[model samples]
Target: MTVESPAAAHARGAAVIGPIHAPKASEIFADLLRQKILDGEFPEGQPLPSERSLGEQSRLSRAAVREAIGILKQQGLIVSKPGRNGGSIVTRPTSQELVASLQTYVRSQGWGADNRTLLEMREIIEPWCAAFAASHRTDEDLQRIRQRLDQASASIDRVEEYVSAGLSWHAAVADAGHNVLLSAFMSAASTPFLSAADHGRYDSLKARKSTLKTHKAITAAISDRDPQRAFDLMARHVQGSEAPLLENLATTLENDTAATG
Candidate 1:
């Protein structure tokens, strides 16, 4: 038998190890760029470096750099438009985006929290959101909230319109809370919660009237800048609105109201 050469043996051994690709170069580059964007190295509305520059820094092919940039755009970190004036531009992270993300996350959790549990969680934080709104809201916030409330009040007979107005009012109150985290939470929760409460028809006629009354009371409390009253009104309004859905809880609330009365 012929003896194999040392070089031949080494070559055969290297072939056995395959191509040695750990991960995609584009993925690594994207990760590095993501950190930079999150770290504010690329501020909102600022243009990102050209693909050529990124390619050189990353020691990657132009195609790989493009892939990385595409990942950033997908993440909503950067936007790219084709044209003379368009390239990769960093995005301003909005509360709306945060809320949308939160909504997606909650949905993904599936059984993590049922509607009742989710509503309860909302109830815990929302009263405080109203109280804060009372002390912190600006004239702009007041105007926005009042406009939506007016629309809701006027649309009592119209289901879709009423739902739309109710959503707007919830969003306005969330904005009025003046806390980014709380605003985002409420914004995310508003659609699902109200949609569930309405059960497809938006709101029952009786429910709509009660909702209008309760909302107006809460708005008045906030407008008057009465934090304690705002909190109380909001709590009462939530308990009342959630009653039909959670019959036993509503019954308990009614019993308490009667006992107190």
Candidate 2:
């Protein structure tokens, strides 16, 4: 073979040495695309670039571009269709999807203690919601609250039924605040606490009666449009009942740890 020029030799040597060991182009592309979706640069229902075009634009192989699209699909950020003009399309993230992801992450990390912390947060935030409901409630709102209270009072003979009704009453108060975002947040935050409370000593006769008394007081304050009184009653109701419930949970956990260890 004829001797190669210096530039040709350098090219041969570089080829033998293999391509530069840079980061995976697919990962970089994926990250860039993900950011675009999150920032609303690629809005929901908008079709993404074709795989071949995206590959050329990003200076990556078609395989890299396709892999990035796969990642976005898995993340609930995009959906893919296969046909003529088929491509990935961005989708709006749903609250249920986000909540499921969060619950999975929290459960994987053994976040029971964090659930307790959320209960503490509810004690503060929910009272404010109740106060807001009290101040802003219309006659129609009062009627709804009264209806829930009536259902709860009727179920007082059965602890489980009563507790379920009681939780509904609080949920109604949150809804009556006329703030959908706050209502959604409180609903998510209280889910774990309500489950725990359902199985706790709050199921006892004396506890049921005490809870009914507190609920009545809170309802009365809300009905009378007494925001300060509603706030105070809610605060005391949470502190008095939640502290004992938590103490019960702590004792149970200690016993469980001792047995398991």
Candidate 3:
């Protein structure tokens, strides 16, 4: 029996997988530009070449160049300017952009409706964030955390206001942790919880008071630079909050199903 050549074997496998489509010129150009920007070849705040210039250098049409530029703009890698001497400017992506993109993706995936998942995420992240803040926090950070805690305490009786302040207090802790990615993720993950609160899914004097009490304790731990205490307090706080949050979510989901049924 004749042995199959490597080329023939590869061709057979390719046939099973079907043909690969070539990327669009715009996509290829956008990828190249993105790499250059990220690699610091094109420094932030520097103007990219004119569309006509880019078209000439890349051997792409003007429309393709424009499309590539638009792609970069959408990805938060660049900003476009109008008028004379105006073109795309290179820029680094910010946490706010990450927050927006993450929020969009989470919403699109129909996440955040399940309280259990959110609680799980919080349990993993917030405790560490609190612990980190204990070591990394500045006086300014402590001040901000204290202010947010006060706001949360004052607003405890009002569901919407309390939720807003409560979220802010959480955000302050994340920020004080000095971890940019975690802070952005926390900000994005908060949207659904805020929505739940807006609907008045769970509101009670007891729960609010409990939250404030735990928040104050966590804040004190961080302020005192006690990472272990901060971690423990935050973990306990998240764990304690879970039952009420989940119960309310379940009730809301049932009522929605009943109404829609």
lDDT of 2: 0.76
Error of 1 at 222 (Å): 0.6
* Per-prediction TM-score: 0.69, 0.64, 0.81
lDDT of 2 by residue, 167-234 (tens): 77887888778876667666565455455655665767787778788888888888888999999888
CA lDDT of each prediction against the hidden true structure:
0.79, 0.76, 0.87
State model 3's lDDT. Answer: 0.87
> Can you write out model 3's per-residue Cα lDDT over 199-222, one digit (the tens) per residue?
433367877887788899999999
Write one digit per residue (lDDT tens) for candidate 1, span 223-249. Answer: 999999989888776665345335767
How many steric clashes between backbone atoms does each model show? Answer: 0, 0, 0
Among all candidates shown, the one with the greatest TM-score: 3
